[model samples]
Target: MGYFRCMLRNRVSLYLVLAGGSRGNGDGDEATTPALALGGEGGIVADLISCLEAVLEEKSGELAFPGLRQVFMLNNKDAIVRRAVRSDLAMFLLSGWARAREERMDRYIKSYLDVSWTPVMSRLAAVAAKPATVTVLRRRRDPLATFNSVLENACSAQRCWKVPRPVLRHVLRRTVSEHVMPAYRRCVEEVEQPAAVRTER
Candidate 1:
């Protein structure tokens, strides 16, 4: 397990570094690098996601479901492991390679959200249900702040900002909205507002 983990980490790091270094240098530049060439053909990204799916499958085999374990593995304490799971996954989701494998990428995106952003939104929804916690002022202003924080962390921590604008819009934005907006709307509606105070004339 350790050897496989180490090898995966090194390959991911090397590919990312090579890809970044090659960009904007010249026309047809990135394709010259073997790693980037494989990435262009969706090989590396596909393999990485396949490995993640295998890990999830193995964890699921231990019990009927392992949602918490999936979350823990994706958000692991080790920076390299965490980056490999979260940041690299985000890169793949927003890459041109994903366009050629839409169904696979879509499934991975759903799995990614099931483990990451969905839980945070669930907690927010739970908190919003409590009248004491979400006071009138908080209901009006604080939820947006909290939501912004969540959105920022979701994008920034996963390096979503590093992708091209069109890819980010078409892929990440749409996926986030589908998963988050409905829950956000529910939370907004569920928040218990305080009774209106009447002003004496």
Candidate 2:
């Protein structure tokens, strides 16, 4: 319909405006044309990213629709703008837009994801399904000291024996949530018990 066509055109204009990075002059005239502004490629690229993110957030539904999708795709390709001039700007913008779209889908739509983590999930499930036993040793006189000793020993064993150095390093450094540290702490709760207790004199 005419309405849809108009909507698509407006979306296309928004993309171009963002890509172009036009600003108004104090005299109320459109100053610094796209070509002129694009001379400073960094600013143009940053503006393009900001604009595309805003547009993607605003037009979440229409972007996924057929006609609008085609329009966005073709325009983003920028066949009209030669590779000599646009260089990789079109490609950069398109990739940013795609990421923005995926993030939007993940945030707004339930069970919708653009990435496949099936292998990771399967590995996690396999590890979790394995049977294991845990034992709390009353080695120290104080219960708290015993618990602390068990926790320390468990964490060291998990870090050094069970997990690879590189994976452990990355997980420890990058994992910011409260659960990550507590999950590491929970290692004490899952250790397999030994048949005999050994203590040094």
Candidate 3:
């Protein structure tokens, strides 16, 4: 138990150190502090995960966890001091939001999620879920396009043709579409940028 605890603590400290952002001063001190304080490794991990997830769900105007999920799993995501490299520097910059739509989202969706979608999320995630998916998010080439597609599907299946899926989906579609989409869209609009930049048109 002691060994596990030490190992965990070290792991947590490592995340903070890496994701902690900023390089040390000439004196070798950190330039910034991690967002959450952890007493134990587990706590650090949990809190950081929760904070990251919370940010995703709310669609706050900041990137939190994105293309870096893989990097995070590999324990390689670190906050950048600046946008020296677009992808790495802005991996956590919040993409499109989903909480600004017009429909009344199913609040029970989350409760249902704890038991239902979690498994499918990981299994068929590439085809069925979206980011902020508690289980597995369906993978798509373009996240924003994925967002639009999911919205269209939700409206169709739900037969409302209005509300977004995943209550946050609705919210983000609304606000994010209005606010962030223009810029983010332009970023993704560059088809030559990457394969995922297929076409939101």
> Which lDDT values do the candidates have, in the order given?
0.52, 0.37, 0.35
Estimate candidate 2's alpha-carbon lDDT, on a 0 to 1 scale.
Answer: 0.37
Which lDDT value does model 3 have at 4?
A: 29
lDDT per residue (tens digit) for residues 33-152 in model 1 = 434445544445556555655675576456332233433333221222334444434444335543443454455456756766875686676656554556655746765566667667
Predicted model with the maximum lDDT = 1
Residue 14 Cα positional deviation in candidate 1, in Å, after optimal superposition: 30
Instruction: Kindly indicate the candidate among 1 and 2 with the higher TM-score.
Output: 1
Error at 153, model 3, angstroms: 10
Worst 10 residues of 3 by lDDT: 75-84
Winning candidate number (TM-score): 1
Q: Give candidate 2 regions above 4 Å deviation.
A: 1-28, 32-132, 136-179, 190-201
Q: Model 2, range 1-201, lDDT digits (tens) per residue? A: 232234344655644765456565556868433433553443444454445545644664465422233223323323222331344344323334444544443343122111112222333333223323122333423223433554455345334222223543344334323423454344423333242431220
Residue 190: error of model 1 in Å?
A: 3.2
Clashing pairs in 1: none
**Residues 105-151 of candidate 3: C-alpha lDDT, one tens digit per residue:** 23322332333223323333332333233222124344445545544
